[model samples]
Target: MTEVSNKTAVDPVERAIRRIQSVYGSWNRNTSVAQMRSDWDAAFAGCTVPESCRQASADGVDGEWIVPADAPRDKAILYFHGGGFRLGSIASHRDLIARIADASGCRVLAVNYRLAPEHRFPAALEDALAAYTWLREQDFKPKDIVLAGDSAGGNLVLTAMLSLRHRGEALPAAGVLMSPWTDLAATGESYLSRATADPIHQRSMILALAKGYMGDGGDPFDPLASPLYADLVGLPPLLIHAGDRETVRDDATMLAEKAKAAGVDVELKVWDGMIHVFQMFSEIPQAQTAMAAIASFLRRHLRLEAERVR
Candidate 1:
């Protein structure tokens, strides 16, 4: 643990996140997905699971509903998890989704989309679309829904919107992204520049995961696979959050710039000295602050009236 006693020392939040990165920094595609999921669960052992939720499976996607006590029934969040498209499930991300649920004061539907090497390319996208359609079937209006995710999940959130647009389907009110990997081609300059600085996520590992997800027939530049190359016009308002220390920093920055150039309402926030998906470290103060910012953005865009209990 970093010294929190010194006044001029690094912030405790920074220290905590760095510690987590150090412990799991070497983790990569070599690790079995099962073990990775187990490790993820252990990393968040301190977090309390949010209250009043149920598990359900429908339309070939598995998910859990996170309904915080006193949450509004009017709006909902469709959440996806991040593990480079190979690992991560609703179980690995339950607490994170629960935190978002608590902060947004709305129910969160976290999808366990199909993983790669087994299911490739459009499989996860199909699942996300299915989950959103299921939510609509539940009577949730398009504008009342908020799509949110981190890392690969963030990429899926963006691509899913593109998929919807291509199909002429309705869109959600807004989208929240955390350190999204918009380019599977790994073409961003930050990938090389921030490689040493980012405590987690190595370029080699990222490419390997991308290969697994892309399979033999998939193209990295496919708009649905890598939304960075996609047209951004007519998309919903977007709130993108990325840490300066992340290797994918340019992914978010470039995506935001491209989206803005294409006339989308985009708010990009780059936090100084933070790493990829810092929001996963709920014990970190910056993580808490970022979640609060997400809540404010969701509230404003969703037009939500309910205040968080915290």
Candidate 2:
């Protein structure tokens, strides 16, 4: 249960999510990437922000960029966009990533990682870890960065954290996950029970995406694919936000339990009646409110220097 008071109605978020699902019911990766992106554009229509407040660079793979407006130079956020690692592009998540930059008071580097049914496993992971390596080589300190993502991107962030830790590199100050699909095995009982309940994600669709991403090489239980299977001994502080109603809610809950058992400081916040990645959809007031909480958590955990001074 959420201990924090939430002022917005959860019903609107649910309705909006269902509306989106209706518009793109159980889409497959067989659609042309162009069509997939265009569909996302149509679905996310009507959201507008100030130009001076949001800028992007497309020179990287697929419109990936470092947003500067309302973006603080003192701190940075490395964000991964979620399309279940099969069907999303940076263009689809541009507005939402900008919101993260604004709320977290940091410069945001939105990564357009490779997708599946084409790139397959380790490709997205390689792209994500490469982004981190590139940022650090550019003089960005690990301690100055906060890693964040939604859905499959959330799994990427956690695995990237572990990858860095295993290599003896310093870890990021914090990590933020929104409705992470950390368990790809479809083991969560909610995967069955909550399929119809979850408006945005259908188990059939996700299982297909998961299979395509897994390819034929290794098990989905591999830490690179499912961070829940990894040893969580050396990661930084983590903040996970999940909707109480998502099919993957059990994923977050299990990961949190494991992290706590491993003696890691994990703050898992479950939003009552909300759905997946609602924080990125401004049409929902609850999303905006959730972003506020996420931003506060990032600042508090990542601002270690300030905390020390205090």
Query: Which candidate gets the maximum lDDT versus the true structure?
Result: 1
Candidate 2 local lDDT, 187-242, one digit each (tens):
88778878877866767777777888997665889887999899998788889999
- Please count the clashing residue pairs in each candidate, in the order shown: 0, 0
Q: Specify the highest-TM-score model's number.
A: 1
* lDDT tens readout by residue for model 1, 59-95: 6689888897877787899998998998777776778
lDDT of 1 at 290: 93
Error of 2 at 194 (Å): 1.7
| Lowest summed lDDT window (length 10), candidate 1 | 41-50
lDDT of 2 at 287: 84
Segments of candidate 1 deviating more than 4 angstroms:
1-31, 306-309
Instruction: Give the per-residue Cα lDDT of candidate 2 at 299.
Output: 71
